[model samples]
Target chain A: MAPTTQTPPSLRPSPATLAITRIVLIAAAVLFLAPVYWLIVSSTKSNPDLISSNGLLFAGNNIVENYTALMSWTQGNFWRWVGNSMLYSTVAGVLGTLVSVSAGYALAKFRMPGKAGIQLAILGGLLMPIALLTVPLYIFFNGLGLTNTIWAVIIPSCVSPFGVFLGRMFVDAGVPDELLEASRLDGSGEVRTFFTLVLRLLAPAMVTIFLFIFVATWNNFLLPLMMLNSAELKPVTLGLYGMMSYFSPQYGAVLQGALLSVIPLVVLFFVLQRYWQSGLTAGAVKG
Target chain B: MSTLTRPTAPERLVTEQRAQANRRRRRREGRIGWGFFAPFAILFVLTFVIPILVSIRSSFFTEKAAGDSLYGGGGMVETFAFLDNYAQVLGNATFWEGMGRVLLFGAFQIPVMLGGALILALLLDSFIVRRVAFFRLSYFLPYAIPGVIAALVWTYIFSPGLSPINQTLGSISEWLTGLLGNNVDLTIDFFAPGTIIASMATMTTWTFMGYNMLIFLAALQAIPHDLYEAARLDGAGEFDIVRRIKVPMVGQATLLAVLLSIIGTVQLFNEPTVLAAVNPWMGNDYTPMMLAYSSMMGTTSPSGAGPASAVSISMAVIAGILAAIFALVQKRSTR
Candidate 1:
């Protein structure tokens, strides 16, 4: 570690290379962000200005009008869809995170038979793409009289095998054997210890898993497209797709809807990104 | 206690009691462990496992009509279909075409996306790029945006009349043409049937490049600094260290990402489905996933349950095979 601190002068990339790297990175950033920047700018323009005006710059301050149009155009269905999105994402994300994390903690700490089999089943589910099962799920839900209901979306989403895997990784890494033993030795009941120590230890991982599941459920399209037939029940992604798929979409309104849909996600990302980024990297490598 | 190298009878009894208590404790803990695991287990089985089983079963059994011919039937009778659904799917040109397009899309796309991600990750890790936070934020911003919205925005951006992309490209090419004294036709239509794959690839690359980059970056960042020192001491240069140590270290991660991407790409629906709104010629069976979905939607035939399941089963099988092959190769290479 001491020798590496010096980082041999030869190991240092030349100034020319650094400049080149900077230039390349900046160029890539500009290109990469063009569409995203366009989305923000273009959503604020009138339909005519959107096409005729310079694509990079905003011509008119039409964000309010576009938003108004979106509200009126969808008959406030967009707001309902957004609500539904929040509902589904939050419920499933929170539920699945709690369940999986607890299961993971138990698996990590307890002496349980068939834990290996359960883990393998989870792995098998991960390998088999869930998107491919949407059709059959649609039929299955139909049989259970759950189709077009929130359950159709929420129930399936409540089991993220990946989240379980991550939770286990976090438990094994974060919660030491000695700590649990000490807690037990202190006469802390199993449930009490779990709530006080294990839950506290697993907080970051739980949040990470929740956010992952939230984003996944929020962005989910295929499952909803299959099961959701009612317009009022549609999540934002499905709602937006419906708007776009119409014969003649109201471009201005749809743009506003799209913009509205991503705002919360983006803000959440910015706020919690640092917390999850480290957790995620650790889990990604270890898992 | 004093003579023999063995415990007395009381000690043995005490040990037996301890073992029994341990067993009881383990049994209690095991019950609690299962209690914790039960929700995920039940939900997983109800959703994932059951769906696969149902699909397989439905694929193998066809609904038998009353009078054996009439459209109107009595109570539903399901007869053993055997390979009838498989035969239907395999013989269908549309399904094959969709399969072909998906394979073709993945063949080119998986490499380029993963390669771009690898390069970006390496660049970020190299410490040459300034404002790493800014790049990380910008690149990862797309991931936060829902796929439907991203595709919608990209679709608008890809629109012929309204597309900033083509408008920008035309000007760039004109400048290039003037500089090089040659014709440069960089104005390719994204919605055109021929270049639709390119557009899809670009959109996918846009959405995932940063994501995969972060994953690769995680792997790269995990490399021990001492390993770098050791390599340098052995006269390994920057490129050698990067290639031999860094790349190989991240090889498992890259393979994992590739496998995940393979699973993802084959199940491509959102982008292409949206794009088909512009170009209708991609047809109902745009990709194998589309074929399965389209059949289930029953746009062509009424209740294409059997065939949709067949396509679903076939796709899962094909993907399983491809994933297995990739896993085998990676294992062999790593070994």
Candidate 2:
């Protein structure tokens, strides 16, 4: 049988069908890009312009003001949130990727006892709903006195079983066994071989894993909402959420803040778009 | 065959044996690949596995009020509650109501979202769509934007006071007011309670459809080309081929997407919570996750942590049971 998600390639489309497909595809693209367009346009407009002008179209002469307002809105606190998000996502991304890559290598290449069990454990981890664990995680953090700290968010995020699972699959399929054997014959240590030979082969998968974890950790909400309280320690997600809760009526400021928060992510996505798509699927194959 | 010849041969044999031993040592060292996985194993046990065990245990305890204390207090000491929290959760009218809504949302939203994704995926996979990568990235870009930001963006789009939808209505009303030469209004309000569910659905589908599409597309691409050639030789129509071949081929991915949707809908919080902030009618307990959040964080539950814990444990159990039931049904059907 053909793969379900693929197109039925046998049916020759009439000219009308072809035209309709193009239109629909264009429409979908427009729909997808519309919100982003609105974000940028709104961010550029002044408070009054934002309130009065067409939200979908560009208005002149308010970009500087919006930047200043966003920067100064919380007594110069927006950057703090940005920094916090960066610190959390960066640390979690690197460590999570490392763990995933190495773990995946072992699971894919090694003949350790309990390998099947570990693989099953990773599957269970993926299926376990975040909501189910949120409350328990909170209480656990409370016991550790790690609540309201960046580590609470960073540390927990580092243990992504899915990442490790992805790392293992990529290494298994992408890296060659012969290369490792050659390196071993040269008398290099296993660690050195991995760092030198296996890592070079697994670079694409690693980048993909890093981007996935970074986006997840950066955009994460409920965990940070449950964990951190001090604004300085708040990642952008939590900071924006807190602002939404406290300043529900300040549309202009909130709008501006929301726009600012999304820019970096959007830029990151565009830069690393290919990795996310390919990496996500490869990780998802077993499921 | 003299004594000198015997000594040289013995020395050569010793050298050969040492080289052989070194080779064996190297092979063992290289083969013991567990070194690479050590960090992940330690972390997985510490953060992921251990916390789950802790959660199961903590679910049994009742928290004390007036401080950050749980258990060991008057009227708050946790005992062998023995499914009491689960009982309370199942019995709680509000909890069930929230769960029912989630179920309803799941039933309707999953198909719509997946169908939309499938259509898009199929369309993209076809030779008709040009700039394929661009469209793919565009569709998937929203998933990249954090949930909080997605929620925020939708919040603006749906907000009555500031939304373009409402603003356009107001503009039309003003135009009517001028044309009629009388004080008349022609705007239709969308913030009504009845339409809020649809509003939330629109937001979620936008955020997730692309993600589902990517998975479906990947699965689609993995299918071999000869299947299509064979179908063509049989003169199967496009729609027929889709129903018979493509759908079945992507069945595993479709099932996974459904499972994920079910779980996600049950824990629906971010969208509704953000909406509630902008729209007063949504209130604190609009969704079960919201209810749990309020119980734990809101002022009414100064001692609400325990009840919140109870509510969450119940929710988890329900999710578990439902998942089990689903897996069973799927297994039977496949068999």
Candidate 3:
């Protein structure tokens, strides 16, 4: 690490190379940020301004009116949708993280039977796209009388096979077996040893797992759409989709609402950008 | 007092025995492992396994609606329609056309998406790029937005009345129409059938390019830095470094992304579904999954729950087969 850290001093590029690299970087940045820029600009504009003005340019005067009209557009249903999204994301994120972390710890630390079966199941779940399961999940939930509630959203999310799989790999690699044995020898109970001692060391992995689950659950649409019938219970994705259906004639308002719905996700991404990157990279490599 | 303090071997043995019993108790406490995995097992089986079985069963049986109210009354599930639904799906020209469209979409999309991602990843990994963290995060921002929201945002951009491009084209069209009076060109309509794939592709590329880019970038970062230094010393250019080193190193990541993209492409639902709501041309049955949904729950008439299930099962099977083939190929290549 020390030797590699010193190599950056000698690594310098010529002016021509720097110019080309800068152009590439700037272009890439623009390509990525164009939709977001459109989103922000469209959000502040009213129906007329959205139609007339340049999408990329800012004529940021309609912010207040847009917010007011958006709030009242569906009789205060938008805020209710936001609340439902929060409830679903928060519950699913926390529970999913817990299940993943604990199961990971067990699989990493123990000599339990059927570990292979569980691990293979997780792999299968990871490989199987959630779309294939959505219909089946709906039918299953319907049979069990679990459809149309926050529990239906939260329940299926709790078994994120990818999370558990990633968490297990993180634990096995990051937390040493000797340390666990030492904790056991010191007369600490397994759960206590895990939560109080091992958890501190597992912070990075935990953060990564939490952010991934949070983002995934926040972006979840199919399951929620299939399960929830009540508009009030719909998460923001389903809610936004419903609004888009009605906003066919009012393209400007649809754009504004679409942009509004993304604010939370943008905030989340910015806050956890580092964790998200490292976690994603790690998962890809291991995968 | 000294004699009492110097006590016995039996006392030490008794304490040692107690400690062993305590160790035994700790060993027994391992059953709490079940407590951890119990919830996962129950939910996994209930949600994933059972539904798949039910779907498979439903795929074979034809639901004959006997009563006046087709839904409320007696619907019978009968024996094997032996490849009938598959035959229908194959014979149904719309299903084949949708499949062809997605194939074209996949062809156009996979290359553009993967290419853009590869370029971005390579550039970001270069030493010349400033603020590596900022570049990485910015590129990945689109994926953070919900698919539904992403589609909605793109829809607004593509809207005829509000779109900037539409206005630009409208002005050009007005000039041309004035010059050539009453013989106006029809190319101004942005959602024309010829252009719908491009529209949908643009939206999809925006949403997922960053995600794939990040995966590639991560793979790029994992490559040994010394490889680049070695190439530079050998007078290799930047392009050479990317071509020879970065791409080869991240082959597995690329392969994984391909498999994932293919699976997602087959399940194409949200983009077309949302777009169809806006434009009549991009109808409800714009894709196979959409076809299934419309068949099962269309406002027209509820026809063929059995066939819908069959189509769905067929999709699942094809996806499964492709996934298996990819997995097998990946395993072999990696080995």
Candidate 4:
């Protein structure tokens, strides 16, 4: 909701209170941005310069060196990890969005037996803490001889019940019953109707769901840690963590890698703020 | 006799036609619905249901070191050890200690974070704050940063060698010592075991406070403007308006945020796990999830899976119980 342009005269806050609010807000913003500021600043400095100089201020002109060294570290494996992360998240996001949205549309529009039970199960799955699933999933994948492969990460991530829940809400809100009925009355098959009629209306919801799933999979560390082993298969998070364990002397490289890992998501987040915000509130309110 | 008991022939014919058409449509709808639902159902079963079942089943079994199997020189055998792993997990001091630590963390962190979020949301929703969009984005920027990176960034800030925080504290302590003419260590050791929890809590707050604030803001926006207008007309002050109207109006959302926080706190892993790399006090068994992870990874036990399953199941139970309790309380309050 947009804020009203003009406040009623009677409801206007006093100048002193307004000033205090502004000051508090600005202080909080600075506190929130402080670490990010430090991150960006430190990524530009050399390891020695990082320790010797003021951390809050810009000091060294070693951005190129730091990034070059970061890229070349670990036999240039950082770039590979970034590639693997991008692949896994993208595949999972697209495929998961498709499955969840289709199911959600069906559940919302079609009359089916056991519909209530299915919806309830989705809700329960949403509430279940995924951290608890890591161990069993590891065991399961280990049994399947799939633990070290990217499939182990992508497969489980593709089944987000929250996405399904969001999909149902989006469909219910975005798609009208009359449109589906009209398509059906025209003798269009269920699949065709969905593809031709409902899919366009569902684009915004799809983007929202896709972005959410992408971010979740992109940020996922525990699953990859539990499932993958080879250095080449590691995502950015686990890759950075592995580096952090032994790269104490080269804090510059680690900071650079961390900053690099965060930059893509931050850019995407700002670009898709509207969809992401609505998606977040949608789940919280409905689920 | 049949004709007398039944409806007229025309009516009977119409009823039969309608029933037949309805059945055909119902069957078609069912087919399409099931067809569409198949993919998700199959994957959900494979990933979620199967793992949960396997965990539940394995939680009741204990791994025994068996002699050479047909294909292997040594193999671990799982025997039906009902309640044994559960007993071990429940009886372990470290497990309870981790649980206690998390409970304490939640108790302190939830209030401060949620309270801060509520206040911020109120301030933004009020007429006093301008440039709401920029402020909202700035506040929520941390949430976009992954938990792993967030921890890493904060580790830089907490590092004594690299942190501006420590540098600032160092000068402040030095100034204090000079003024008092006595040696006083006033600088905060963020990595110290005693302060690690608070430090971690602060990081957690930093990451989640804005996210929660957005939820509260959404709820606040949903409140009808007329209610606020009415309150203002009745000579209600800003504090009174917030207290009397906004808070109660957002009760459901507040409860939802609280419940989600409870579930989230119970499963706290990523932040502490990342921070443990920099801080020695945060051991492998720092939280229940970590303990379970360490156990599952065979760091804590020779037969790790059984005990790890028990630990995970226990965590799930605790989360479910807490969620149920919150739901009950919220229902009661509403009633």
Best by DockQ: 4
**What value does the lDDT take at residue B231 in candidate 2?**
84
Lowest summed lDDT across 10 adjacent residues in model 4 chain A is found at A1-10
- Write one digit per residue (lDDT tens) for candidate 4, span A1-287: 43446776766778899899999899999999989989988888887788888888888688888777777776689888888988999999999999999999888888999998998898888888888888999887888898999899999989989888888899999999998888889999888988888889999899999998898899888899999999999999898888876665477778889988888889998999999778867854653
Model 3 spans with C-alpha error above 4 angstroms: A1-14, A247-249, B1-35, B66-83, B168-188, B232-237, B298-305, B324-335
| Candidate 1 error regions (>4 Å) | A1-8, A185-187, B1-15, B64-69, B74-76, B171-186
**Which portions of model 2 show Cα errors greater than 4 Å?**
A1-12, B1-33, B64-80, B169-188, B298-306, B331-335
For candidate 2, write residues A1-287 as lDDT tens digits.
22334644444467798898989999999998888788767766666676777777776667666667666666688988888888999999999998889888888777776677887888888877777667767777787899988788988888787798788789878988888889989999888988888888888889899988888888778888888888788888777777777753345666678877777887888888778877757734566
Q: In candidate 2, what are the lDDT values of residues B142-205, reduced to their tens digit?
A: 8877887788888777765557766777788888889998876655455577777777787888
Q: Which ten residues in a row have the lowest lDDT in candidate 2 chain A?
A: A1-10
Error of 2 at B48 (Å): 2.3
> Which residue runs of candidate 4 sit more than 4 Å off their true CA positions?
A1-5, B1-6, B68-73
| Docking class of predicted structure 2 | acceptable
Tens digit per residue, CA lDDT, model 3, B1-335: 85478758888788899999987765664466656666667777876778788777766666565566857367554657767766777678777777778778888998899999898887777756557778778878889888888888887778777676676667778889999887565435557899888888988998999889888888887877788879989988767887888888898888888888888887788889788878876777788777776665543223455567666776777777876787788779768
lDDT of 1 by residue, B1-335 (tens): 47367888998899899999999999998998887777777888899878778888889877656565677457667778899989888888887887777788889998998998888788888744557888877878888988778898999998976888788888899999999998997987888878888889888888988888888888888888789878888998878988999899888788888888889888888889888876788776798888888888877542467778888889888889899999998898778
Most accurate candidate by lDDT: 4
Position B219, candidate 2: lDDT: 83
User: Model 1, A49-104: lDDT tens per residue?
Assistant: 88788889879788888888787767789889999999999999999998888878
Angstrom error of the Cα, residue B240, model 1: value is 1.0
User: Using TM-score as the measure, which candidate wins?
Assistant: 4
lDDT of each: 0.84, 0.77, 0.77, 0.87
